[model samples]
Target: MTLVIKPLRKAVLPVAGLGTRFLPATKAMPKEMLPVVDRPLIQYAIDEARAAGIEEFCLITGRGKDSLIDYFDVAFELETTLRERNKLDALEALGPTSIEAGALSAVRQQEPLGLGHAIWCARSFIGDDPFAILLPDDVVKSDVPCLKQLVDVYNQTGGNVLAVTEVPREHTNRYGILKTGEDDGRLVEVKGLVEKPKPEDAPSNLSIIGRYILTADVMPHLSKLERGAGGEVQLTDAMAKVIGHAPFHGLRYEGRRFDCGNKVGYLEAQIAFSIDRPDLGDAVRAFLKNYTG
Candidate 1:
């Protein structure tokens, strides 16, 4: 029997966290709306998904997250001002911010449950097809976007696919670790998934990260609403149950990833992104040298 794989047209972005780590700044704005260079963290994730051919996007949001929802809306007044000023560059720059009517949806996660719960909140929008899940805090910079890399892997392996990067075994407690049945450098066949296991008990140092292309069947597991580590409905728990049913593989990305949710990580993303921008690179490098000296 030829395995059937449906086209992935929708993506889910779980942005409901309180972002307590970046408080004060985050207190007034959603962390997803936090600017990395010029574009907000969530926008980068959305752009990556759009580049992968996802036509519709669903954001799992929460209170104080109105800014994230509004980011995709058309700024008629701003556009008019730019038009009148003949700021062609600024006007064209706004083009990507225009999400087509009915193409984007934002659902509220009433409770601050867990990542799995936030994802489950968007179930109605997901329907039956497989969808991608991206965590905005984990900003991955790639020549070919990280999510796009995973989408290509999903096309080849119809089962659930997620991005993974190897970490030290001592640090396995920091991430969900994977057990393997087969391995080839970029793609590894997943035999098991353990959420933050102790170093001695962890099956492998290969750890699952933020990007995921999950099949619809995983919804039932999420529906169970079972609380796991951290006393929350963990996404890892749901994914663990999904292992034997079909092919599950961890894909190592060809890119650099930054954890933009914390202060140090956020600063790192700003510097990394700035150093790559033509307008800011030279000045930023000069400033860095003087500061270091």
Candidate 2:
């Protein structure tokens, strides 16, 4: 028998959540539209997806999130003004933000369901191909984009690829923890997944992060729409259904992951990203000195 692995081309970004954690800041805007340094959190996720050779993207959005749909659309009026003013630098900056022709799509998640339901809303856009699901909340800064790392593994292993990181045993109750069957440093055989299990009953410290490269077959399981974990449709529950039948593995990606979902993490991401910028690094570093006084 011969093995055939499809080239990963499409990515789904679930950005529909009401950013209740951020309160008034998110009261009017989607949390994804929140800036990290110069760019919004969603932009970083898009840049990463593009770097991973993704040709198309499906954005799962909710009410008050139309800004995301407008973000990538060509700003004809803005472009016209910039062109007339000969602002070539500003024009060039927009190049990376442009999604491929007919490749950008936005699907609405009618309800404030869980992550699994959010992903299911994009099923029509997913069709029947191997695709990636990237959560904008987890902004990973890496020489090799996090999703690209998993795609490379999927190329060699040919099944499901989940980007994972080791969490503290005490923190296991907060995330989908993985039980490893074999350890190979960067890659490990996924024996089982326990969603937010108590610290003592946890199998391993390996916890699933926001990045995922799932095969099309997993959609059917999600279609069942069974509620799990927090009484909401859990993506972990759907993924667990296909555990034994698929080639699932957790990869310890080499990167600095910033959880932009929470307040502290969001502030940290701003500082971290600012430090990486050539123009802003010096000014930001200088500002940090005044805080000691």
Candidate 3:
């Protein structure tokens, strides 16, 4: 059997949700724009995609989300100002980070349906290619890059690959749980998926994270708009339909994941990322010591 790995060229980011969890903070800004350290949440997700060799980005946005698109746009005035101030390094950094003119495209998800609907909105951009789907809420810090690891496994197996992590059994109801099959060390065959099953009903402790490499075939399933657990079209429900027909597996990624969608998780991510910064580590450590002492 000849193995051919289709290079994942495009990635879809569903940023259309009205982030009600953060409330007042999210009132003016898209939740995806919330900063983790210095970079916005979406920027981290885009950086992860860039590290994984993904070239094109398809952002599914909603009303008041123009800022998300503009964030990645070229800032002519800002660049000129930086140049006049002799801040060439800062100018270079800012320009390099914005998505190149033609590299990014956005589609509007007019209604705030669900994750499945948001992804379906980007169907035209996805075309016939196998693409990546990344949820900005689950931010993974890793040396190898989480999506890149899944891409590697997708190449060998030629199937849908999802990033998986072992969550506490008691917290199984909070995540999309995966039922396991033959274990191949890092890649575990996915027998089925249970969306937020009760702890006792969960098939396994392995919960699906936000990173996914899906075939275009998934678009049709997403279009079904079948309401699942929360009366919203669930992506897991669509993913479940494709199990046996397509080779579905989970990649045990090596990394630390932060759920920045919640208040506590957001604060924890800020602390973790701040401590890892070379310039701020000492000061942050000193502050922490003083506070705890």
Candidate 4:
């Protein structure tokens, strides 16, 4: 049977977590708003989605996340000040921050359920369409946007695709592990998925990261709200249910992923991103050399 692939147009970003890990700083501000170099962490995810041809965005938000919305809105006062000061570069920088009126929307996840539940909150926006899900916590740096790599693979395979990477076998419990069928260096056939499995129970080291291209069929499973690992509705479990029904596969995306939900990873992303920036690279490199030396 020839599989038909939908043109990927929409992306859902689950930003409802309280970010308990980054407390104090995140106490008042949403972790998604934290600055990595200059732009906020969530902006990187949005930028990546746009690069992958995503036209509409749904932010599954929670309380205290009004700033995420504000970040995308035109800052009349700020823009006016920049214009008056003739700061053309500064004004230009804000361009990407604006979205067309109907291109973006937000839905509140009133409760802090699991990832599955947060995604389910966007059902209305995702009705009857295959969509992409990007977790802002997993900030990836790549020459080709990580989600685009998955989109390319999805175009060829026409089923659910996930961004996966090999993790240390001993640390398999930290991620959703993949059970494989075929062996291609860049893409692996996903026969099964296990969430936070112990090393002994883990099928393989290939861990599912934050990027996913899922079929609309998975929504029915998510709607069931079955709680799995951590006693929360596990998206992994729902996705696993679709394995036998779809052309499920995992792409070993070309990128460096930083777990920005944690302090260490967040700090690492800051330095890594700063060192890659044209405006900050030289000064950051010098500071690093002086500090390390």
For candidate 1, the 10 contiguous residues with the lowest summed lDDT are 62-71
Tell me the lDDT of model 4 at 269.
92
C-alpha root-mean-square deviation, candidate 1: 1.0
Candidates in order: C-alpha RMSD to true structure = 1.0, 1.1, 1.3, 0.9
Q: What are the TM-scores, per candidate, against the unseen true structure?
A: 0.98, 0.97, 0.96, 0.98
Candidates in order have lDDT scores of 0.91, 0.90, 0.90, 0.93
Give the deviation of candidate 4 from the true structure as CA RMSD.
Answer: 0.9
What would the TM-score be for candidate 1 when compared with the true structure?
0.98
- Please report how far candidate 1 places residue 217 from its true position, in Å: 0.9
State the lDDT of candidate 2 residue by residue for 194-234, as single tens digits.
Answer: 88999999999999999999988889988989988888889
Give the least accurate 10-residue stretch of model 2, judged by summed lDDT: 92-101
Number of clashes found in candidate 3: 0
Off by over 4 Å in 3: 1-4
Expressed as tens digits, the lDDT of each residue in 1-293 for candidate 3 is: 65555778899999998899999988999999999888899999999999888999999999999999999998889988999999988887785468987999999999877888888889899998999999999899888889989888888888799999999999999889999999877889999998999999999999999999998878788888888888877888888888997789999999999999999999999999999999898899899997788
Native-to-model Cα distance after best TM-score fit, residue 159 in candidate 1, in Å: 0.9
Which clashing pairs does model 3 show? none
